[model samples]
Structures are given as structure tokens and as C-alpha cells.
Target: MKTYQDQIGNVLGLKKTPLRIVSLVPSQTELLVDLGLKDSIVGITKFCIHPSSLRKEKTIVGGTKTINTEKIKTLQPDIILCNKEENTKEIVEACLKIAPTHVSDIFTIDDVIELINQYGEIFDCVSKSSEILDDLTNKLTNFQQFIKGEKTIKVAYFIWKNPWMVAGNTTFINHLLELNNFENVFRDKERYPEVDITKRSSVDAILLSSEPYPFKEKHILELQKKLPNVKVILVDGEMFSWYGSRLLKAFEYFKTLRNSI
Candidate 1:
């Protein structure tokens, strides 16, 4: 058996390329399919909706934070994919008992690329992984060029409501927000934190995400009243947060978003 170390530095022994794959992370699930491993994917979480038909085709163990271990055990996967932030330690320990588990910890695009490369190594899909890396690097370069001269927009990105949480430091969403030249007002804070935006008078705009809470036009209108001087717009949550093959489209979406702003 060959030993492989994950992003978090945990090592697992694999006899061969993982043929029966179970992905617990939604973004990784999409990346696996894109890297030409769709046929090998036998299980996924309910949130893995990128391919749309994947949920119907694959057995869903459960959601990101919560999973059905019994369902996962029954699937009897050759390997399981997970993410540090998305899955709990309990989940990792649980999966490790069943099969070799690869956990990725990503806070930036570079980390995402490394994860892709690691997947290529373990799954033996080097060509496809290289293709994706090339495309992603090119798109990222184009975006950097486009955003070079753009004015930095001071914005607060909202991911949820009812307590009102915003993406802050050390998050994938914050990384993308910074790339879009949007200065997160909550940058000094760590992780997703609940805040009273009305107190943040320096914020120039408020961005409501379309997922994790599905902020809509009505919510935008509501915030507009509270922050009449500040611009409030609905942003695609996937484009800003998903750190996988979805990033292929994210760069293009960033171009559009900056233009609209």
C-alpha cells in the first residue's frame, strides 16, 4: 500500500487508485466529477448539487455538518473526501474507520490548486487535472488584469440572516471578496460573525448571498431602507464561496459583478 498525506497532514494508506469515491464536500464533489471521476463517485452529501443529476444518481449520506454514518458504511466506499471547515472532526474520525479519508483545508486559490493536484495523484487523472489547472490559472490571470485598475469597494458580504452573519477573515468567501477588490468591513473579525450592520457606517455597500440562507429581492429592499445611503445588491453565493471546479466560472462572474457594481 502507498501512503498519502492530506492537506491537514493526516496520512492514509491506499492500495491503488480510489475507484469507489464518496465526497462529503460539495465543491470537492463537483471537482471530482470535472476531473473525470464521476463514474467512480458512489456517494455524496445532499449539498453536492453542481451536476444537478448527481444527487439523483449518487447515494446521499447527509448534509455537510451532519451525516448518516450508516448510509456511508453501507456504500462501502474505497475512499472518502472531506474538507476541514465543512466537516467536523467527528465526521473525519467516523469516515476514517470506514475507509481511507482525504481531508482538504483550503483558504485560497493556491490551496485549491494543490488539492486538485493531490486528487490527480491519488486518482491517477493527471491529464484532466492539468487541463483544469491550466484553464483556472488563465482565467484567474484575466480577472487580475481586469481588476487591476478598478476602485476598491468597501462592502459587507452577508451569508445568512435572522442573526445576520457576514463572511469575515480566513474564509473562502472573504478571499474571493478581496479578489473582487471589495474590502470586507468585518475583516478584523474572524470567521462568520453576527453583526449589527447599522453600526458599520463606513461600509459603502451590502452584498447579500443567494445561498446558505437564499437572500432575495425582498431582503435587499429591507436592508436598503436601513442603509439608504449604502448600496445593497444580491450576489451569487456559489461564485463567491465555492472553491472547486465552480471557480472556473467564478472569475467570469467576478468580472460581471465588478461591472455591475
Candidate 2:
């Protein structure tokens, strides 16, 4: 057995190399595959669709928030991976009964790097982890340089509708928005807050995200009707919110997004 510490300061003891793994977090699941643990991963959430073939090859344990503990236990996972924000405390407790669970809490890019590094040690994929980290670092540096002189735009990034919610402070989406030189109009609020755009007077643009709520073009017209003067655009939510291997391509996407704006 080997000892491992998760990002949230939880310590777990894992059977060496964890041949059978269950991943509940979509982004972390993709990172596990990129770190060369694809075949070792015995189960994953239905939302882990990155490789596209993963669901066919691995057992679907459940969604990020709603996990099937019985299904996960049946997989005989030696280790289980989770994210603090993505999974509930109940899910974590249930997984602990089935296998050693490593829960990650990430806000910034540095947290992602550290999580990848820890995965490398636990899964014995040091070289692959280093390669991913190096690529992420270089891309981040390039993006920083690319966005250096760009004007910061005040924007409201919407993650949901009906009630109409948007990303606020202390979230990964907010962190990426700052990185992209897009100042969040709701930066003062906490987490994802429901808002009345009619009341928000300082927004320069309105970005509708493609996930959590999957904002459509028609929705653009709806929001535009409310905030006629504001620019409303549909954005890929994965680019701004997904951490791990996806970030390798995200920097390039950010550059294109900024150019278009």
C-alpha cells in the first residue's frame, strides 16, 4: 500500500499503482487517460466523454453530482478520483467505503498542475505527467503574452437560464475569465448567483455558456431583448471551465476568442 494526499488535505492509502480505478470528475477522468491510465480506469461517469470511446470501454458509475455507489463498488476499484466542487460530501463518504478516494479542490491553474503531479506519483506515470505539465505551462505563458496588451472587457458570463444564473467569485470560470482579460461584472458576488440582467447596468457583453445549461442561439435573442445594447455570444464552456489536458488546447481557443471579440 502507498499513502496519497488529496488536494483537500485528505490522506488515503492506495494499493500500489491502483490497477482498477473509478473516476467521477469529467475533467480529472480525461487527465487520468492523458496520464497513461486509460486501461487501468475501470469506471467513469457518463459525462466523461472526452476520448468519446471511454464510455464504451469503461463502466458508467454515474454523474459527477449523482453517483451510483453500488455500481462503483462492483467495479472493485482500487482507487477513486473526485473533485470537491463536482462531487458531494455524501459521494465522497460512499466512495471511501468502496476504495481509496482522492478528492481534488481546484480554483487556479497551479492547483491543476499539483493534482496532475500527485496523480503521476499515485499511478506511476511520472514522464507522462511531466509532459502534460510542461505543455500546459508553455501554453499558459504564450496566452499570457498574447493577452498582455488586450483591453479588459466587463462581461457577465451566464451558466444557466430560466432563473438566469451567472458565474461569480471563487470559481474556475471566474479565474479563466480574468486570465482571458474578461473582467467579470459579477465578481463581487459569491459562486453562481441568479440575477436579473435588467438590474445589472455595468455589463459590456453577455456570454452564454454551452454547458451546465447549454445556452442556445435562440437564448441569445432572449437575453439581447433584455440587454439590447450588450453583445451576447455563445461560448464553449469547456474551454473556460475544464481543467487538466483540455487546457493544452484551451489557450489556443482563448486567443481565437479574444481576436474575434
- TM, every model: 0.98, 0.98
Using lDDT, give the best candidate's number. Answer: 1
Cα lDDT of model 2 by residue, 1-261, tens digit:
779789999999865778998999999889988888898989999999999999999999889889888888788988999999999999999998888999999899999889889988999999999999999999999999999999999999999988999999999999999999999989999999998878888888899999989889999998888778999989999998889999999999888888877
- Over 4 Å off, model 1: none
Tell me the deviation in Å of residue 52 in model 1.
0.7
lDDT of each: 0.93, 0.91
TM-score between candidate 2 and the true structure: 0.98
